[model samples]
Target: MSMNTLPRIEGPHADGADPAGWCDATRAYLPQSTWTGLFPGGSATSAAKALLDMQMLLPGEEGRFTRRFSRAVPGRPRLYGINVDRVMVYKAG
Candidate 1:
């Protein structure tokens, strides 16, 4: 979906808040495929860019990751410093 059609993000605070929390809050509004597409390159920079471009993340949010955020691969599940499967993974600190 285009940025114009995406959900309206309120407040910079919410946009730059916890990634997982934002994902959970937006789950009802966004499709899982949207999140999946955000990390096409499995790099934290790219993923953050996608989110920034989409207005899901604000500028400088990309630097929050201690490691690159990886996408899910065969026989491997995504990690976001939490116990969840098929989610993005990165060390946000």
Candidate 2:
């Protein structure tokens, strides 16, 4: 995807603020172990990396202001609650 398509929106802070939103958004879909692995510290940096590594992120950057564009992991099986296929994850850190 082109850089222009990636939204420049900032995400929740890298610190442990508003963690419930992040967890609620991601954890239910991922296996417990996988969820733990991706967000051991519950930080936005980890969220960015996980989304990028999964090939869900486009690309852009700056200081603590990195940008990531992500969509749901398309073919991943739903391990828990509802499928998040329509979810689009955006993280900036």
Candidate 3:
């Protein structure tokens, strides 16, 4: 993607206070994880990296936010309800 086409947006925790907005891009991204299921797992460092890379916004139910993007894994999408994990969401927008 071009420099202007990059989706440089992120959403902070609902209870978070500091404006975790991206202050830099070129050196910001998602954290690295190691492979446990399908792919290797990675660290939750992206949230921090994104803090300085992408513009931080408040978390929302839907829409393009950091949760929608960062929470995305190899196959799984979101985990709703109790501790039950989920692969795809059926909620309507």
Q: What would the per-residue lDDT of candidate 3 be over residues 20-88, giving only the tens digit for each residue?
A: 122123322221121122123452334433422333323324542234324422322321111101111
Off by over 4 Å in 1: 10-35, 47-57, 60-93
lDDT of each: 0.34, 0.35, 0.27
Candidate 2, RMSD to the unseen true structure:
14.9
User: Candidate 1's residue-wise lDDT over 5-92, tens digit each?
Assistant: 4333342333233332212232212223444554555665576555545444533324542222222212222322212121223234
Name the lDDT of candidate 3.
0.27
- Could you give me the TM-score of model 3 versus the true structure? 0.16
Error of 2 at 72 (Å): 25
Where is the poorest 10-residue window by lDDT in model 3?
A: 79-88
The TM-score, computed over Cα atoms with residue i paired to residue i, of candidate 1 is 0.23
lDDT, candidate 3, residue 53?
Answer: 38
Query: What is candidate 1's local distance difference test score?
Result: 0.34
Assess candidate 2 and give its lDDT: 0.35
